[model samples]
Target: MNILVLCTGNSARSILLESILNRFGEGRVTAWSAGSKPAGQVHPQSLRLLQAKGFDTSAARSKSWDEFEGPQAPVMDAVITVCGSAASEPCPIWPGAPVRAHWGVEDPAAADEADWDVAFETAYAQLKRRADAFLALDFETLDADKLRDRMNLIGQD
Candidate 1:
């Protein structure tokens, strides 16, 4: 399945979700990420966190959702929003009308300078937890109806 994870900036949360999904989705799912208003570059701390976790940060980038709306764009099976802004924003008309879900998470980039590392870490942990739950799903054992039902319930917290 091809999945698209979205957020407002595509720099932190969406990037994190894309990395985790790529690593843990086990070839059964191909993941991509984009933002409504991209930051134009991946956040430095997000890159560091992915690198520290042994994920390749090389391909990480902040890109606009417009990239996925063209005729050449890949058909998505699911489009999950990892931030509140993107989740609630009006979305582009995705091909195949991909299943949509909201896994809203705190935006580390929005944090004040009190303790930036802790804020990033908190966001990373939450994204990791959601990714693990998403990867653990037994899709092979369930029909499409059942699978969609289960995926919708993930990351409710």
Candidate 2:
């Protein structure tokens, strides 16, 4: 399965979720993340935390959602918005009409720099729980409606 995670900045929460999904999904899923309005660079703290957790940080970047609207882009199985603003804004017509879900997390990037570690860790834990729940489902047997319903319910926790 292919998944796309989105946020307003794409610098922290989205990046963190993308890395978590890719790392934890093993070979079963591929994940990407982008922003409605990108910050043009991945937040350093996000890179630091992900790297500390042994994730490959080379491809981590803040990019626009427009990049995924093209014909060459991967067709997503799901599109998850990880922030309130991104969840509320209009989204691009994702290829394949991926199931959409909002798993809102407080933006760690918006927190004070002194508290970045705590903020990032909190967001990471919340998102990891959701990602793990999604990964636990048997996607091959589940229909799209069932999958979408479960994904939405997972976000509620």
Candidate 3:
């Protein structure tokens, strides 16, 4: 399965979730992340946390959602919004009719520099919890509607 995580900035929460999903999904799922309005670079604290957790940080970047709207783009099975703004805004039409869900999380990037680590840690924990729940689902047996419903419940985690 292919999943896309989105946020307004794409610097922290979305990036964190993307890394979490890719690492935890093993070979079963491929994950990508982008923003409605990118910050142009991944947040420094986000990079540090991901690296500290032994995740590959090289591919982490802040990018626009437009990159996934092209003909050759990977067709996402699901698209999850991790912030309120991206969830509320009218999103671009992704190539495939990806099931959409909102996993609203507080923006760690919006926190003060001195509090960055704590904020990032909190966001990481929440995202990891939700992603873990998602990975536990029986995708092979679940239909799209059932998967969507389960995804919504996972978002609430």
The residue ranges of model 2 lying beyond 4 angstroms of the native Cα positions read 85-96
What lDDT would candidate 3 get against the real structure? 0.85
How many pairs collide in each candidate, listed in order?
Answer: 0, 0, 0
* TM-score per candidate: 0.86, 0.91, 0.91
Q: After superposition, how far is residue 1 of candidate 2 from its true place, in Å?
A: 0.6
lDDT of each: 0.80, 0.86, 0.85
Model 3 Cα lDDT, one tens digit per residue, 116-135? 98999999999999999999
Evaluate model 1: give its TM-score: 0.86
- The sequence of per-residue lDDT tens digits that candidate 1 reaches over residues 13-83 is 88988988899888988899998889999988889888998999888899998998878998887888877
Give Cα distance to truth, residue 14, candidate 3, Å: 0.6
Top candidate (lDDT): 2
lDDT of 2 at 87: 31
For model 2, how does the per-residue alpha-carbon lDDT over 1-157 read when each residue is reduced to its tens digit?
A: 8899988888998999999999999888899999988999999999999988899999889999999987798888888888754336543334465588888887888789999999999999999999999999997688888888999899899
